[model samples]
Target: MSRSQRKQEDPDLGVLSSRTLFSLQRELFTKLGEQGHPDLRPRHGAVLAYLDVAGSRATDLATQSGQHKQVIGTLVDELVALGYVERQPDPADRRAKLIVPTEKGLDHMAKSDAILAEMEAEHAKAVGEEAYAEFKRVFRLVAARQAGS
Candidate 1:
């Protein structure tokens, strides 16, 4: 956007980060869904990112996602219905169930990784590789700090 247009829209610069990120995320996921992952949703991204390919449990997902069991359960239910995950009896604790990723889930993860790499390249080109790398470094540091807190 032109400088005057940006200033007119947001003199405080309050909505820039979150609004742009949300818009970029939405566009990326929407295009991805059109490509092949039609069942995925924006809300599913967090829990899905935390999931291990080997296996886990609803409680584990909840812990990793920093969300409640009920919330993770809802996401798991959607994922299960969409054939991305399957629940099987946990061998260690027969009373508990293990949430395992289906082949389709792994496939989607791989595709999403590639798409993110492409996005990184685009960012690098826009701001130069050194700036982009520093940006990512700072982002990771902030995320790690927030995660610790």
Candidate 2:
């Protein structure tokens, strides 16, 4: 069957889209592994992404990530073991510890950005550049609304 025919025959295009996205993420993580950036699971990557952007305390990360503190703590421990993040004393509260991404983590984030950029370029090539930009804008708006809900 033609590729388009197969896609049209699929009952759950949304599910297929989600699976495709998951596979793409796995492929990107595999590339990261080959580069010796530490083997990171999606949960670990989520925490790292959060730290890269917000530089929050563990409790804050747990809350923001909608993960239990113990679970988040375990992920943080793995990150620390991998040398991607470190627990530093929080300046605002000497009793609290802040989870901070290391240089390696920042480097990994840069690599992730490059990967995303490459994907974006592919999308722009497949769909017209203007369509790709519109797709991104609409996706971002929908995502923002979903997050609010």
Candidate 3:
């Protein structure tokens, strides 16, 4: 079958474009793995992306990432075992602990930032800067709308 025919068969990809989003995420994770964070998975990214520089409670991270507290707790445990995150007593609440990124987590985030920049450059080149910018603008708008909803 021709490429056009295949695309027509999956028109949702052209309109909704979730495939593109997932593909980009996979590419970024692949880049991260190649850069030395071999154990990191896309699931780990949910917690990492929402993590605050100061520190965040696992429950807060779960809410921010739209994940359950138990799932976040498990991921946080793995991250701690990997030396990417550490739990410390929360001064505000002695019964709770805050999840803080370790030096290793900071390093991974640094590499992720660089890789994302490179990916953006490549995407801009492939899709034209104007189109890429529009894509980002639309994504932000959609996200905002969803948040409002």
Candidate 4:
């Protein structure tokens, strides 16, 4: 059978997931740009999304983001050049470094959180809060199962 024909017969979970992620990223970065963070990109989320407010190790960010350590290091370098994050001595482990957010990074985080909250609220409103909650629960289950986690 042809690829398109097979696609029509099967569930499009992968395609749907990709489309949803891309849409969210597009909306998110557009708003971020308008809010004074034009330099931010979707790739930056690999670090920003997993980064803790206090600070995080590059290895931790890599693990949390499911990215290679080298990739995380490159992202960290870009973030450092952009003035969003800085490397500071880790107090817990003197030999390790912590990726801490700067004032600008904090502002970006706050704005991103607010934007995502608004987007989720709109989704919940459109599909009824309880239904959206259930969708999330089921989606999480499916995602975890698929990931074998």
Candidate 5:
């Protein structure tokens, strides 16, 4: 059976979550593109979403993003080539490298944060503020549980 048919037959939590995630990603990337970071793609979020302005090690990013170290390394390389990030010496561990955001990356991060806030506000408005807050709370709990699993 086709994917749509399967969804229609059983609209489970997994299906709903996947659909919501994809929709959110589409809206987010489209807005980001309009804001001048058109080069970013959904896959890039693996690194960008978990990245810290102060810089982080690839292993940290991998853990935060729930991706493999090798995958994180590849994403970091892409981000570096795109001028979003660079490798710098870790102050604490001179031999280890930190993934530091460049000026362009900082700008992108700021823009993304603003966009996400706007989106959240819109959602809250759509579903009553209290209801939205509760929804987010439940989502976080469920996500944490699933991560452990």
Candidate 6:
């Protein structure tokens, strides 16, 4: 579907707009910064979100984030330095290190989730219940396709 048509049909779907996504991301990062987490950029936040779902090796993160392995390695280093994550010896593969969120990371995620939940509530209020539900369903389907690619 055309981007404009989608936006008009459901304002919440406008979140797919790069400008809108960036703005929302910046707002969330600002909120994180205010919470005393200064270096939590969107990329770093994505890494945290991924790790939150399950601990994974660096290679796994690279694949899931669609980022180069080298780039994800650099980010992982930064996250380790910031104490938001730690590398643990992967039991399944001793040579590979699994990235896991620290306690502080989990706490930060809780706060971040609260902010995101508020944003979602605003989106639902704007788009109505039915459209909001469809938006989530379709968005997930699209995301799965993109991830597979």
The residue-level lDDT of candidate 5 at 111 comes to 92
Q: Is candidate 2 or candidate 6 better by lDDT?
A: 6
The sequence of per-residue lDDT tens digits that candidate 6 reaches over residues 13-93 is 335456667988999889889987877889885477667434788887787777888988989899999988898898898
Residue 69 lDDT (model 2): 90
Measured with C-alpha atoms, the lDDT of residue 61 in candidate 1 is 84
Per-residue lDDT of 49-86 in model 4, one digit per residue for the tens?
Answer: 98899999999999888899999999999999999999
lDDT of 5 by residue, 3-93 (tens): 8898889888898899888998999999999999999999999999989999999999999998999999999999999999999999999
Candidate 1 at 9: error in angstroms?
A: 8.0
Tens-place lDDT per residue, model 3, 1-149, is: 98778777766534456677678789988988888888998889878988887789998998888899999999999999999999999999999999999998998888888988998999999999999999999988987788788
Write down the RMSD of all candidates, one decimal each. Answer: 3.9, 4.0, 3.2, 1.7, 1.9, 4.2
Error of 3 at 37 (Å): 0.9
Order the candidate numbers by TM-score, best to worst.
5, 4, 3, 6, 1, 2
Say which candidate scores most in TM-score.
5
Off by over 4 Å in 2: 1-17
Where does candidate 4 clash, by residue pair? none
Off by over 4 Å in 1: 1-17
List lDDT for all candidates, in order.
Answer: 0.82, 0.78, 0.87, 0.95, 0.94, 0.81
Number of the candidate with higher lDDT, 2 or 4: 4
Best by lDDT: 4
Please write out the lDDT profile of model 1 over residues 22-83, one tens digit for every residue. 87678778777977898798788756777788888889888877889999888888999999
Ten contiguous residues with the weakest lDDT in model 6:
11-20
Q: What lDDT would candidate 4 get against the real structure?
A: 0.95
Clashes of 3: 0
Residue range with the least summed lDDT across 10 consecutive positions in model 1: 11-20
Candidate 5 — worst ten consecutive residues by lDDT sum? 3-12
TM-score of each: 0.80, 0.77, 0.83, 0.93, 0.93, 0.81
Candidate 1 similarity to native, TM-score? 0.80
Instruction: Count clashing residue pairs per candidate.
Output: 0, 0, 0, 0, 0, 0
How do all the candidates rank in terms of lDDT, highest first?
4, 5, 3, 1, 6, 2
